[model samples]
Target: MSTPLSLDRIQHAPKALLHDHLDGGLRPATVLELADQFGYDDLPATELDALTEFFRTAAHSGSLERYLEPFAHTVGVMQTAEALHRVAYECVEDLAADNVVYAEIRFAPELHIDGGLSLDEVVDAVLAGFVDGERAAAGTGRAITVRCLVTAMRHAARSREIAELAIRFRDRGVVGFDIAGAEAGYPPTRHLDAFEYMRGNNARFTIHAGEAFGLPSIHEAIAFCGADRLGHGVRIVDDITVDEDGTAKLGRLASILRDKRIPLEMCPTSNVQTGAAASIAEHPFDKLARLRFRVTVNTDNRLISDTSMSQEMARLVEAFGYGWSDLERFTINAMKSAFIPFPERLAIIDDVIKPRYAVLVG
Candidate 1:
């Protein structure tokens, strides 16, 4: 194999992001603009630079609840349809600029209901924004597809309702369903009705598990809830045991994951920011990859984690000595796990993602 490629070039490489929070990835300038337009005076800082620093500090505090405060600011300004459109448009533009070929951005529609918009209306606004974004990016000669993953806040009792909303928008732009928020108190089984409904409809869904919680959460999400993929399933590392002679024995749970081909949407920076992992060096990504688990890299929250797909890939390269082939594998893993239809997913891999990566590593 050739010498490992540099991180900077990875920024130009095509990437697939299967896990990212729509509200968590807003631009700071957009937040300021929306806050100003709505006369919402709750901003911790008024100046752009200060506001950026405020978000960074909050996310770096290593508290999940504190890290989520910026969303309150972003969501506060996104009540109006126009504001939601702008944020969604900008999100696509930013990701396209970062060379993300395909991304599944997720958020809870119920959160935007506080702005006096119904769940369907909120979905329409975001979908309209995505259409505008795709058109704009096409003019710039960049192809980026943004799919929505309707998230139901786990603590709230709206999972089944949100699942129906996701199905409603399936033909329009929404791709899948997800359960997000505090993982400890709100187990995936709590929203069993929604998962069952999605399963019956043959719809795709993922669950946020093993991030702030442990293996049981992941277990319930997969075994009980039938998660098509796992969101931040980093805690599966807890089930791995290493012997003095370097022999690794995966626990029964880990074995099931490997055997069943469950994809782990591992976000290194976000894991560190949320205290899921002690540090990037200690992240289980390398171990998981080595064990041949269906591992894919992602920027869970681009704004809060201060990460892009390239940055996440670069970190893995440096930390685990990954090369071009490894990066290619990661991208393929994401493509395989995407909730899109089989033909469309294959088209993206064959016609777009693979061709781009071929030139990079050739």
Candidate 2:
């Protein structure tokens, strides 16, 4: 039996996000306003709706370069403290409206330093925005909490610096560290020193791997770098062998990943957009979820992919015929894999997530 999870139901369902990008999920109008304020005339579209369509199209072009093109404009305009705060605040507002009870948004601090703000200043501004956003959500009778992840671009040479920065801000609203950017030419191993620093300092981190590349990236992220969670680990599917009769065999790496219970932060729509997965139905999310490999759903970029947590869940339901139980399980998995303290994670699951789902499933 299947429970029909309509759009309204999906929107009201409690959700947890583990892999969202701050620069990639801007509001179109906000982008335009910031660009105008910053005097950035490089935007492809001046009109709001046209800009939205342009982003959606570029992201869906099935080329990674095209998919990342929109971030140039978003990040270009977000170089100031006020712009960063506004973007971060609006992110919380948007997620709360979609019933995201908890989220961890990641952005590279090195990219926003062009506006003459120190790395510390960038983080401070973003955290302040999150705090304000949470209070504002409370005023609206909604509950939402957000954490930031300081990211370093893999293709760049600032991983070590960013790692130390993440450790410095660990006590603040910054929850973890990460390395993002192109994965093919520049491997995660290039940032091994950063990962080791995080491990030595007892800090947590997630690595972008196996989305555009293959199992090698996944292997390094787990075996080499010790990623607490994987950003778009969908390509781990390549190691699995499935027969026409439905029998499945797991390869060595796949076996290790399953046995170790490494969380796979899979973003279905973003995967499709980057050609990481051919389509949502063909996505390995169902296989990974069935195997119980600590899989969690995420929206890699809301504005670029034109998705939200609710939309992601709704698409999964339509593609894989999932129900309320499946949705609840995904939410719980994400909550469990959060970078927050253990007691706090438990509190959210027991006190907030589970209860909210129970009411919906009832």
Candidate 3:
């Protein structure tokens, strides 16, 4: 018998996450304690409820720029290595408990340097946390493997430098490099050298595109920067049109994306909160999935969006009436698109994901 497609049940199915942010998933109490410990008293709220509401409110302002405003506090408290380690460890614990077996959590190393640590020190601290988190989660019988995707803020000029940093630690928990920030003016093409550097080093990367911006951003990320994957490529829907009979037509760009099988890291909750999609009901995930686009579900910022992998899948089930098989397909899509080596990705898929999902998708 098949398991019901409920949120609680969904947590038992192994999942792979690719687009989550490290700083954005901090627990409210962690933020508060870190702030108090570090003498950074600029938080807008002292209590948990008020702080949680503050983040949710900022995220729901329907503006990408505004949605990112709450990160100042989380990143502010995370300057020291101890804070980064704590945040990274907790992020794994939360994801592991949510049944995320494999995750590539991302953060900007440059942002943490404001606390007086070097960029290398920042990366080392986070990696150490991930190693410890993996061990602890395994001890708890969850068995999660967490990797890092060092991010370069799109508005900054350190893209090349950060790309190099990702390469230096590629053997460690760091598997990939990424560029993220407000997408209004800072297009991915601005960081061509960084992407080129990754490519030159035979590294993989995904670009933040088609989220707040449009196809132009997507175009540059793919065509110019050679992004291995797209971060929130939801806006590719702009190039598509559906007929009255439900037949969908794909534009050239969309056709290329589909034909190339480039992964679209679609974060539904974060997309809605950031106005990338008007609401969950109107998200293009269903249409894109039906069209055979390499669409994968993700939680861009779990704490900010108040979401988890289970919550993301459950919301899809609620909105589009998806079933367990649908969730399995999305999970497999993420694993297939993971930046890990082909053998490693396949091992997890065949051993962990397929077997666990076989029971849920019975």
* Every model's TM-score: 0.98, 0.98, 0.98
Candidate 1 clashing pairs, residues 3+ apart or interchain: none
Rank candidates, lDDT, best first.
3, 2, 1
lDDT of 1 by residue, 1-362 (tens): 45666777898898999999888889999999898988878989999999998877788867667667678887888887888899899989999998888999998899997778899999999999988998898799888888999999999999999999988899999999999887878899999999999988889999999999999999999899999999989999899999999899999989998999999999999898888988888899998999999999999888888888989998888787888888988998999999988898899999988888889887
Query: Which pairs in model 3 have colliding backbones?
Result: none
Cα displacement (Å) at residue 315, model 1: 1.2
Per-residue lDDT of 1-362 in model 2, one digit per residue for the tens?
A: 45567877889889999999999889999999999989989999999989999987887977776788789999999899999999999999999999999999999999998989999999989999999999999899889989989999998999999999998889888889999988889889999999999999998999999988999999999999999999989899999999999988999999999898889899999999999999999999999999888999999999999999999999999898888889999999999999999999999999999999899878
Q: What's the lDDT for all of these models?
A: 0.89, 0.92, 0.93
Q: Which residue ranges in model 3 land beyond 4 Å of their true spot? A: 1-4
What is the clash count for each candidate, in the order shown?
A: 0, 0, 0
Candidate 1 lDDT trough over 10 residues, lowest sum: 61-70
